[model samples]
Target: MSYDKEVGLRMNWPMIVYISLVHIVACYSIYNTITRPHYMLTYVWTIILWFISGFGITAGAHRLWSHRSYKARYPLRVLLMIFNSIANQGSVIHWVRDHRLHHLYSDTDKDPHDSQRGFFYSHVGWLLVRKPKRVLDAGRKISLNDLYKDNILLIQHRLCPWWNMLWCFIFPAIVGYYLWDESILNGILLPGVFRYCFVLHATWCVNSVVHQWGPKPYDNKSHTTENGIVAFIALGEGWHNYHHTFDWDYVTAEMGAIKQYNPTKVFIDIMYYLGLAYNLRRAYPKGWEHLKSRNIRKLGGEYHVVEGIYGIPPFCHRTVTYVQGEGGGGGRLLSETQVDNMSTTDEEGL
Candidate 1:
């Protein structure tokens, strides 16, 4: 009966049609690349561009802005802004607001992509259908005041439609037409449409595949899980159980998983070494082992994780050490107030 419960599915036909058309064209583009051997360069570019766009979401929107998992210098922030435009999922402010809401409310009716609504609903149906009243009401409580103050996010939010069209599709097509001597049509199909669609689905998997499969080691009582395959495809975000348990950790996955399939972690690490990123946070004060699958969350209660600049829930359960800079194993621990101020200062990066 729970599975059969109707949560209202008024269809947003335009969105449904657009998504369907994108998938069909993406499939055709894959076939086109195979048959047209000359499209080798375009194919390679598609893969490279996919990761570039994903960085915008995973690093720019999710980690840096949404969760405040780390802080980035102006140069890196600008670069990530450009990358997020290429990803074209949404503006950083909108994306972060939705993400924060998803975390605070999780799989309840308030969650935009509620996993209990079924895989298709979580994966894409939420977008294809008009949002229910509950979802809208839940979203209203989640504010974007912090995000709006950031000039970088504000500009991106204003021009996302125009710039996204340019970077996500038109620019890539132009490169194929001029640099690669590929047809504009093939360019749009291969790297433009196909890659855009590919990134969308892969990110969506975190909402669907991640919630359904894998182990819930950190908080067994929670709805999320850890899936290595999703992590690999998503550039390391698929450790949903760990992430939900320790949402403030900049690594998102396990502490010492740089060698694993978590390129997003490595990308942030590279930026840290280059002095482009700093003030990265770590797991909850007690780390994963202490949770021991305990229900660390209670509805509308304070989350028991480290607080970041962007979204610190009402309460934290303990006063233990939360590593900074490196993975959870080593690094100086900052008091809560220090962590909040670190993002704005010119302090030497770790």
Candidate 2:
């Protein structure tokens, strides 16, 4: 199956069937809630599962695995792997592969979920249709060497199908059944199917809504934007513009304070304090200030300021050390001012 120019658009039947069934079940669950509401416990369970699965994708797959934003202890890594499986997007390796490609060629033909293809395609249409040759070719060029070195990630990928089924469907349904003492059917429909559907769409919204809406305060070269609504639903992943600009930042935004909606950063911070995570990476203060000063949205008078717990750090003129663990490589200690001056044309432009 391919979507190359010569091959045209080919339907990915497996994905199509899976998505269709989930939606159908979700719709039925909605009707069930309206007509014959389940015990409040069932609703509560659904919301809980939604957060768990959503955070799994945001913190586990996106930040931890894909970006290697920080190092985690073995126990924390295993826990996040379980959460990632429960999210049911894909194995860690597969998710990181496509995500790295998306960042490398975002908003372009090579991007798997290119916004230029329109909202639907970027959101979920890309999944229903086969991957384009350009996307596949680009993905192959991106390195997964770091991920391959991680035993936890490799083990999870090897057993993904089994764990995904267990954590995503079986475990959630069992919890629902035991908590509400309801029919197994009710448990599967409400917490399993409905919750899965909700989390999937919420994650997809970052690819769709985040690109189409919000302000591009980091870089206007891409269509990605900062969407607070999406950040709230996607568990702190909605700061798309900032993310595209500073792809290596563990916080995913310039503002790293906890009072913001970035629960993922908070989670990582907690792990760091507990000695379960370390080498937390973030954008340099000088680079962030430079980008903020030159924000296209601000220049156009369309950017709105939202006060948060931490303002942007003041600019630094002293020499800076460029550490590497966030993007999965060795550190390079360069002069901070020199790096800031060169950042405009460097691979990771501020």
Name the top lDDT candidate.
Answer: 1
lDDT of each prediction vs. the true structure?
Answer: 0.77, 0.75
Q: Against the true structure, what is each candidate's TM-score? A: 0.79, 0.80
Q: Give the per-residue lDDT of model 2 (tens digit) for 1-350.
A: 22345466688999999899889988998887788757788878888787778878887899988887777888998888888888888898998899999988877888899888889999999999889877888888989998899898888789878878788888877876776676677778878888888889999999999899865545655688777778778888887777888888888876654434687788888889999999888885876755544432222323322222222222101111333334424444332233334434333322
Candidate 1 C-alpha error for residue 217, in Å:
0.9
lDDT of 1 at 109: 81
Cα misplacement distance, residue 4 of candidate 1 (Å): 12
Global Cα lDDT for candidate 1: 0.77
Q: Model 1 over residues 209-228: C-alpha lDDT tens digits? A: 98898755455557787677
